[model samples]
Target: MTATTTVTTTATTSAAAAVTGVGVVLPGLNEPGGLRHGPVAGADPVDPAALIGKKGLRFKDRATQLGLCMAAAALTDAGLLGPRGLLVPGDRVGVVVSSNLGNADTVCRAVATIAEENTGALSPMDTPNASSNIIASEIAIRFGLRGPNLTVCNGVTSGLDALRWARLTLRSGRADHMVVAGVEPDNDVTRRLTGARMVDGGAAVVVSRTDAAGAAAPRVLLGPSFRTEKLPDCVAALADAVPGPAREAAAGLWLGPDPSAVPPGGETADLSGWGDCSGALGLLHCATAVAWADSGRTEPVYALLGGAGGEASGTVWIPVERAA
Candidate 1:
């Protein structure tokens, strides 16, 4: 018999991160009417040139290109960038990216070149993309987000973990706004590693202090809380941190990398339609919840992610008034 896992949601006392804007680069999400229904079948893949233009894309890998485009759209949506450049000082912004297989193709190819041909055979232009922090660094460098730049490579929980870090950074007064993105590229290397076709794009969001958001922008309070625990202990541990609302009121919907373990009971949605998003699913979860709240859904939603080693991470999102 297969072992089953149970998931639940509760509140925490930490300060919430306000979502000011969102952007998605997935096949269907970027298209007209795409936000209403995410990741439709046979949708066209993201055209980096179309969204962000052709300059500076030559040396960047597919994942980095997609991530840059997604971040640009999100930043533009948040009104962070103006005609000249960033409205806020470059030193006040930060970037956080999460991807399990991002740039894997570039890294693997570089390694193969070193093994088969010679170290000199590796192109200098491609060498930088092999670094683990390439995507995050590129985003910061291009957009002048000179604050704190980080990339999350944690397995399935990387997406939520990235968001958790962003919240902490804001509360600690590190940066005013955190540009968070989760991305994965459809490529031969990633496909072979995961044994499936990969999603060619990802999602992004602009999160900041509640007071920093515009008065009329659609907003939601993201948990300042994040817990990594075993499956059974997750609910109890999170529920005990801070308590006030009913379970249903706290999280009317639950989303994660693996909802199959959630049992056939509560409302749940699968991420497969987005393709093998892997680490990008958590960010997508936040974007989807924001869309729901934008459409006038009031109750909070939960995104709980469990990793391969029985470790889990989760956060709560409560929709607020448009003025919030």
Candidate 2:
């Protein structure tokens, strides 16, 4: 049951990608009804039922499962649930995977097998998951999508950068629809590498041309202005590039090691619940924004992400009219 949306404002860039559907898999809030934010606890995110086809999950690893499930949820939410959510033609749909340390456990397992025996010892089924790009490849193969597939390996703001890239891809006339995912599956390897309260699931968003904004209004307008940089610098940069909306009760994000210092004139979404989802954080932030906007109690939502070395990224969300 996809909600109807309507965009009131005229197109700003005329080629920006409109976020038609958003799916977030935070184990912390895997309720039956819909995705929502909750208090932060040292816990793993639970996957939804029937998240993917049995064949798809047959030989895939946990990282693959997380990504597949999120992609399904996003596509379904977008009202594109045609034979595993491939409503558009294959080539017109692209997939971009963003992650800090994508599928580390799979890579480590391959390396260990190689060290123990030899290259021949590595399982062919396990080898594909080792590559970060496999996440995107899996989505393409699952939904019969033949569009350009890419993987972005930035830092914590990988998801944000991926969204920017997806929008650019649409503007370039590369694809009619784009699926961008930022995934971080829980595993011992990730726990050791990063001491954050790793959530087991990830997040995905269905992107299309701004003309499709009405499909899922409360549109998150991503354009050339949305970018990843440093914290205060990125915030200041966004202020210069795109000014804040004229809505009251606006929401903003100030994410980092310590996100205590809120921005000057906007509100920040609570990221305490999902823990350090790493690559998945940006999409989680987006889910929070969409949920907040579509919840009747509308407000302007802004996504602000800060990474290591003072890197930051941001996006603007306007809940013009979201279905209840």
RMSD in Å for all candidates: 4.1, 7.6
Candidate 2 C-alpha lDDT tens digits along 1-324: 974332122224323566778776665554212434454356545643455546658667776777888888787777766663555567777898887766888888888988989999888877888887877888888887787788888776777777777877877888877888888876788888888667677678888876642244425555324443346555544444334453332334333324454445555445655556777777776666566655554444566666545556766555445444
Q: Scored by CA lDDT, what does every candidate get?
A: 0.77, 0.65
**Candidate whose lDDT is highest:** 1
So what's the TM-score on candidate 1?
0.88
**lDDT (10s digit) by residue, model 1, range 72-190:** 87888888976677888778789999999999999899989999999999999999999999999999988999989999988877888889888878778888889999999998899
lDDT of 2: 0.65
Q: Whole-model lDDT for model 1 versus the true structure?
A: 0.77
- Using all chains and alpha carbons, the TM-scores for the candidates as numbered come to 0.88, 0.82
lDDT of 1 at 90: 78
